[model samples]
Target: MSSTCVSPALPDSKTATTDPLPDIAASAPTHASTLDWVGMEDISLPLYLAGQPVLARASAGVSLDAAGARGIHMSRLYGALRELESRELDAARLSGVLEAFLASHEGLSSVAEVRLAGALPLERPALVSEAAGWKRYPFRIAARSEAGAVALELEIEVGYSSTCPCSAALARQAIQEQFDRDFSQSAVDAATVREWLGRAEGIVATPHSQRSEATVTVGLDPLVPTLPLPTLIDRVERALGTALQTAVKRVDEKAFALANGRNLMFCEDAVRRLDDALNADYAPQGYRVHVRHRESLHAHDAVARVERRAPDNR
Candidate 1:
């Protein structure tokens, strides 16, 4: 009875509520947008090249913009490249890669770019012997898409021998005269002299043989796709006929010397040969060819660019 009387003294108005107001979170601040490009660089991977799988590394770049965001989704750019990992890096496959990159971002109108630099094996006949070995060279491929159009670029570095026509003729004439005067039955000089004359014998009649490099770029039409890399390489080598090679044997070396003699050329000849090869192969594709030769003779580099004119509709 005492406990009941004490409880009854506490009125309902004096009692406190068991529950408090629910916690509420403030809204996040919105940021202004800007144009941006993001991606991963120098990623190492393995790729199939020249019928063999070899290690390849790549540098990837992507760009996109949003209406209200400051930058693009950087992680997405890397993710796009990751998805392309195991896929072929050919012209067709590259289109898919660019498509995915562009699709990864919502507001981006232009697709990003991917550039891969790696080693490629070139099977070359031994210089002295008929046996063959592989030579590794630096290779690069770049691709990008803009306004629903895609462009692919391929770069390959190859070493080849260039014999001078002018020097060769002069050397031959000098050797003939020396043999006629001496009558010593020694038509050619010692090994050292022969080597020296071989290099010096050219059309230009210079002491030093010209060491040259060729860089060619062709603009491809989307409608006519596919890049015939191997074919192009073969055509180029055929045009020059003196491709530099490693692992040479005596027989192969002799053969190479003959080839060099057969295809002696100047810097201008080399550039023209490249142009002819490209024009013949890409005639239907409608591509413009650009050729540059780093000449050893002149201080300045020699460059030649040619574009096929548009077909007449009439």
Candidate 2:
């Protein structure tokens, strides 16, 4: 009687179940309400832009139109983003990704969107030297698929040097006053003035210049085949006329200084330059330009913004 007790056998994990695992998202919500957007953000991924690989942070989402469903399948949205790594990014590829997003969440979503943010590396040559270096321009690509149509947008940030117009005028006035004090009593001679101009005392006051940035966003026309990031960058840099240099010898530095002097611009001037450039050639559906000058003379930054819409778009 004392030896009669025995333990029962446990079920093997391998044979525990042949049935599917529970999916909570397939069930109804406790309180059903549709969400405007539902999905993932800050998903790290590798993206190819113009055949160059870049590390990107992606946000993928879809409108949650299914009021009864607990949630859309977030993994499906992430899976669709894999397309970004496979090929050079363009409007068509971006639209394809959005299409995949909607396909994966069909019947539960009508609108899908994807955003990619990364730095694009471009080789930049020195202004007056044979040397070259890589410059990373931060950019963002946003695309949405709604009502069976796709809309694409591109954004880029370009850095440049900006010399304040008012500051330049003020500095020139100060230098003129100083020159009058120095040469008022003496008869001015060309050779003597040349010697004086070479000295630091001759150019006593200098215009305030600062590292400035222009952020441009444009709605891409569907007919545009590729992502025109490099072209847009070139256009913006050319318009601004004093793009930040990567590698510089003394000659290049001097050339850069000369360029800045010749291209003195306030934030307003920078915005208008960008506006004219974008409107003239790269006619997007619409565009917005925002310029910021990080002031060396003041603690606060100077900023300006301009926006335009195509007549047809309006």
Candidate 3:
């Protein structure tokens, strides 16, 4: 029997939609492979560091331990960063954030890491004047949690003046030769020497000095209650003995010049000074020191580096 058959009327497409949204990352990957690190970087955020509010760039990541899983929950890692904004950054706080990352990932991750970078501003008083100005110290903090342990590291940059020892010696010799030539035929007297010293001809040459920078990275002890950023910076600057100044008056400039003259050093001297200071005073778990002297006498920069790790860590 030939009969026309009509299917029951179907629901409209708009009203019939009932499927859930797609989550591609929740599905198994086409190629199963464990990734070491996956997440976000250079994320701008506001956080408290060294007890001061700072705008920092953050990086959050976790290891993709599950081979079959397409990816870790990146949003969870990003969401965990909110803790940094609510509290002052420290080893304990960072460790907590990492723990949150692992908890959120559950079986998908075994390791988590967070990094923050920003400039710390401190108001510095002039060497011999009432003037004070802000000095910005660039710093980075990196923390990682794995196997129920947390590791923290801090890196900072300090600027100073470095006068070349060899240049100072050569300049002294030049001045001595000039003095000998001037006084060989004349009678020696305090007034005569003072007057000669006041003249430009007396000091024939000046030692070459240049602005230098020290970049120090140290592994923080887990027991440390707070990040020792200001203390570490003070130590580095004191070791160099000629920190760069802000809001300089004539007296401050003269004082700085005197400091540079007293602390004549090459890149090697600068690095060794920092190494000795850190070893004797701070005694961190591990540390790396790098000094760069931007040379005024030559086009090339002089640099020195030193690295040390505690015996147990090594």
Candidate 4:
């Protein structure tokens, strides 16, 4: 054989322009898709918190791995998020950013995700005082893309008071028995018994108390985008009726105590109430939700979760 021999079919003009189907295949080549997780993290940015322009920061994370890509286009992930920072990041703005992330990595058809978390302040309206200020709440915002679908989740932490119903009833019974015994003695008066029992150790015995918290996740409709964080917080606080306050006066403390007694709830009670509230507010419009309560009595925590089916996936 000669050292430089040409192939016989090298100049076959008959089959020069093979089938056009290979170029039109709407999928990646076999060896370009195999990354596990990719995206951004701890990227600081600003946010308009609770209707106020606040300099808030967040950790933005994303992943772009398809069925067979070796790795994601790392540069493209940053570029996509840069577009988000250039534009304001509202709920609507965040959804658009997710779309941009998917479009940036063409072969990444399966794994696409974004996460943002920051502390947001809530503007309080002075429930029991004259001076009005803001309350800061920790919020976590996350988004994910898979199979042409995207979702957003919000986690909010709120503080509230909870009184035990069982304790309250027992206290009332003890007070009644004291009055009856004082009447039988004919020397000690009912008022004296009340004064003695009103001491700290006497009146408030074994009162089960907890600072309740609620965590909710919602799937947003791209067509109609809005962050429901403020609305959700208000609903949760009202339902529980004993939220902890940053600024308080004597009058405020009294009102808060009254509220706690009126809305006494166990951990189970709080979860059920929150589940009902979320279903009524968000389920009909296509949103998923979950709630958790941190117990004060037991060492371990109590959690509750609920979800509404999406329109297409139902």
Query: Over the full model, what C-alpha lDDT does candidate 4 score relative to the true structure?
Result: 0.65
**TM agreement with the true structure for every prediction:** 0.70, 0.93, 0.92, 0.74
Between candidates 2 and 4, which one is better according to lDDT? 2
Q: Per-residue error at 166 for model 1, in Å?
A: 2.6
* Runs of candidate 4 exceeding 4 Å displacement: 1-33, 53-69, 86-88, 108-111, 187-206, 285-314
State candidate 3's TM-score: 0.92
**Between the candidate structures 1 and 2, which one is better when assessed by TM-score?**
2
Estimate, for each residue in 178-283, the C-alpha lDDT of model 4 and write its tens digit: 5565466567667776686776544544456677666656555545456777887888888777777766778887887778778877666776777677775566
lDDT of each prediction vs. the true structure? 0.62, 0.91, 0.91, 0.65
Q: Is candidate 1 or candidate 3 better by TM-score?
A: 3
lDDT of 1: 0.62
TM-score of 4: 0.74
Write the residue-wise lDDT of candidate 2 on 188-281 in tens digits: 8899999988889999989999999999999987658889999999999999999999888999999999999999998999999999999965
What local lDDT score does residue 18 receive in model 3, on the 0 to 100 scale? 73
Worst lDDT 10-window in candidate 1: 22-31
Candidate 1 lDDT, 70-100, residue by residue in tens: 4455566666666545644467666776788
**Candidate 2 least-lDDT 10 residues:** 1-10
How far in Å is the alpha carbon of 197 misplaced in model 1?
A: 13
The residue pairs in collision within model 4 are 32-69, 33-68, 33-69, 33-70, 34-68, 34-69, 34-70
